[model samples]
Target: MAIEPLAIGVCSWSLQVKNVAELKVFLDRLGIDVVQIACGDPHHAAWDEGDAMPAAARAAGFRMSGAMLGFPGEDYTTPQTIERTGGFGDPATRAERTERFKWALSRTKELGLADLMLHAGFIPAVGAPERKAFLDTLAQVSDLALRAGVTVAFETGQESSTLLRRTLDDLKCPNLKINFDPANMLLYDNDDPIQAIELLAPDIRSVHVKDANRPSTKGVWGEEVPLGRGQTDTRRFIQTLKKAGYRGPLCIEREAGTQSERFHDIEYGVHFLRECLAG
Candidate 1:
């Protein structure tokens, strides 16, 4: 079978829209029909229609590349705050987060998607006391995804690619893969995005086309900028993805601006990616 060319899409939450209707309007304006939709979870991007969102999204006509899920208490206010709350990182929240993951898996199936993307949180170092529990939680979620026939893509950046690669190796779950975001590597002041992609190439199931500059201080968050405007070197990022054999959709995610600014930036990103892909 022939491989489909990569499609350029946007994250639904990036548009900051409230419902499927609003999302459609923006998608039309952006001139793109592809999206990686939020699951309408209270924390990430809640829909005005609530429970009716799945059916509405399924009927919305846009091509959904995947679904995104964010936990309720995830705090992006600071690096430390998220380290304490993001993903399945907190041992205290593992049970509840696992249940949330179950719900997200169901939503992925309902939306006719095979991939669900989320941050697995900051990983515990290999020899740390919490390492075993963290890996076990990841395995539990991965097993759930396996049974559901959905691929769970943990977004990169919370930890170094080496640690993530090690964790994946330990779990050995075929359904668990990566949703590579080059900008995140810089934002979290983790690994070099270019090198990280090379290391995690085989497991990259999706890509987020974003850009950012490293933080000035060690513990501070980096600055997120429009595509091709920061340190991500987006043109080279696309080239690297191509060289790494990644053929998934490139979903533009701009979370740093007002809704109007975000829309404009994403629109610009569409053109930026098209130019890079063509080159």
Candidate 2:
């Protein structure tokens, strides 16, 4: 079968603006067609206001693919947690992660979304024991997701592609997929953004279109750049995704900047990606 090119979209925190109508109007002006909502506790949640979500998207004539579900143990600074345990092998940590996973699962359903993405906890491959533990946790989470009837994805980073592939192989769950964020791999200094396409292509369900500096800084996070202007080869990346048969949304995430800057960057990114897909 022939592969299809990706559809473009934007992941916005702009909905947090006091004037959501204005924001939607702005997005429409930029021609953004999709928005990935950020899910979390009601107070800090991205689209907590009951009427904010559908109203804004409706006004703009945009579709919402899903929300980025916030999971517990997200705080890596904590002393003892799934994140500290390296994402899913410790029994106690897995229990905690399970609770967080359940919360995300329930929240996504409540939002009437069929798909969501999250950090599957990072298990650094420091040794044999750590590797085994990480695999165990991956299996457990995959099982949890199977019961939820929703697609759950692990945002790339925190591990090498080989290790991630191995982890997925061990679990063998159909629902578990990759939310391929090229900048993440580059930011972590783990792999080249373009190379990751070959390693993770088959498992990708969604993508985060952004850019970053090269991984020459050694343990430091890469700087986030606007689309088509960073270490990620946005054009080739999209072409590779198409070759891999990934047809999911290309969600543009702009993590920095003021409302004006963010809106501009995201709009620029959406257009950049649209051109990439077309080419």
Candidate 3:
């Protein structure tokens, strides 16, 4: 089978749009038809049409690369808060979150997409008391995805590539892959995104084309900037992706700015990626 050439696109939620109509408007403005859409979970990006979002998106005349799900009650105010509340990390929230994942899998099928992306939260260190439970929750979710015929791509950066890689090896779930986000490694102060690509390349199913600078203060969030404006080295990032054989859509995600600002930055990101890919 021939691999598809890499295409540049954007995350639907990054536009901060409230409905499929609004998303279409922005997609047209950006002149791109490919997107990784939100699953209309209240915590992520809820749509005005509510349960009808899937139908609306189907008729919206764009290509959906995948669907994204953010569990309810996830707080991103600080690294600490997110570590505690993100994904299947906390044993207390496993049952509820697993149900949410099931719903997302159905929604993904409705969207006619095979990939679902999400943050798996901060992974517990090897041999930690809570580690077993965390891995067990992930395995359950992976099993659900396999049955749904959907590939779940966990977003990177909640932990080191080493740990994430080990977790994947431990689970050995074929459907459980990775959604590579370069800026995330910087934001979380976890690892060098470039080096991480080499380690996690084989399992990379999608890519997020954003840029960021490492946090000056430990335990704080990094600074997200327009593409090509941060320490991510946009040019090298693209080059590395190609070398690593990741030929997926580059979805621009801007989570640190206002609605208007995010739009502007994403627009810039599209052009920036064009140059990188072209070069």
Candidate 4:
């Protein structure tokens, strides 16, 4: 049997770089060409106004496996806070966020990319009136992506895989998918990310390579540790994805630690994942 070659990458935001040129320097040292970028950061000049950043990143030999969108007022301090003010959840901010989502979709299309990931806030329970509104909001943005020929991938772990899967099934939107993040599972204290793979495999468009420990107490945030140093079983996780027939980039995402430390972790992650893939 022929083993699949590893396609490791890093999220641009994880590197804390200002632009694609800086990102290229690090990616070259890491020996990779793919990156998952937060497409429209207001502070980042490259993504300030137009398609310039994506174009330049490509010229510098980087291929975007995915793009990310983040809404203003997303508070991760507490679950309640985020539920009250995260993603497109708040009615007061829905209109503005909706417009942002549309614009982000346009950029995703212009970058010639397919997978766009974002937080959709905590999903309400099935049959809840609020669920309808959430689905309706998602449909509107998904329609824009469909027209733009882009796949809108929701990053996993904010909600249970079951809820997300049910939502996608009900929506039945072809352009909707999932970017599985196992660390998020532990961070959110949701279902096991390994089992999540079994459940959400069909919809997994991409995956994030990170690690975190489960929250020790309810209503508290979990701790994020370096890749393979937390709760995730790195080897088994990659095996699960491979078993599920997912053959996409496993992007490194280190949102904690100092800049140099984070870079070291991501560099180690690339080699670690490569070993897992080979094993």
Top candidate on lDDT is: 1
> Once superposed on the true structure, which residue ranges of model 4 sit more than 4 Å away at CA?
1-6, 42-51
Q: Provide the TM-score for each candidate, comma-separated.
A: 0.97, 0.83, 0.97, 0.94
Q: Provide the overall lDDT of each model, using Cα atoms, as 2-decimal numbers.
A: 0.91, 0.69, 0.91, 0.82
Q: Which residue pairs does candidate 2 place in steric collision?
A: none
lDDT of 1 at 83: 94
**Candidate 1, position 184, lDDT:** 91
The digit string of per-residue lDDT tens for model 2 on 36-153 reads 6666433224443444554444455556677676544344432234245544545566676677777777666765676778776675564666676666676767777678778888
Arrange candidates by lDDT, descending: 1, 3, 4, 2
TM-score of 4: 0.94
> How do the residues 1-279 of candidate 1 rate in per-residue lDDT, one tens digit apiece?
122558889999999999999999999998988899999886678999887888998898889989999999999999999999999988899899899899999999988888999999999998999999889888888889989999999999999999999989988999999999989999999989998888899999998999999999999999999999999999988998898899888999999889999999999999999999999
Better of 1 and 3 by lDDT: 1
List ranges where model 1 is wrong by over 4 Å.
Answer: 1-3
Instruction: Provide backbone clash counts, one per model.
Output: 0, 0, 0, 0
lDDT of 3 by residue, 1-279 (tens): 122468888898889899999999999999888898999987678999988989999998988899999999999999999988999888899899999999999999988889999999888999999888888888988899999899999999999999999999999999999999999999999999999999999999999888999999999999988999999998999999999998898899998789999998898888888888889
Residue 256 of model 1, lDDT score? 87
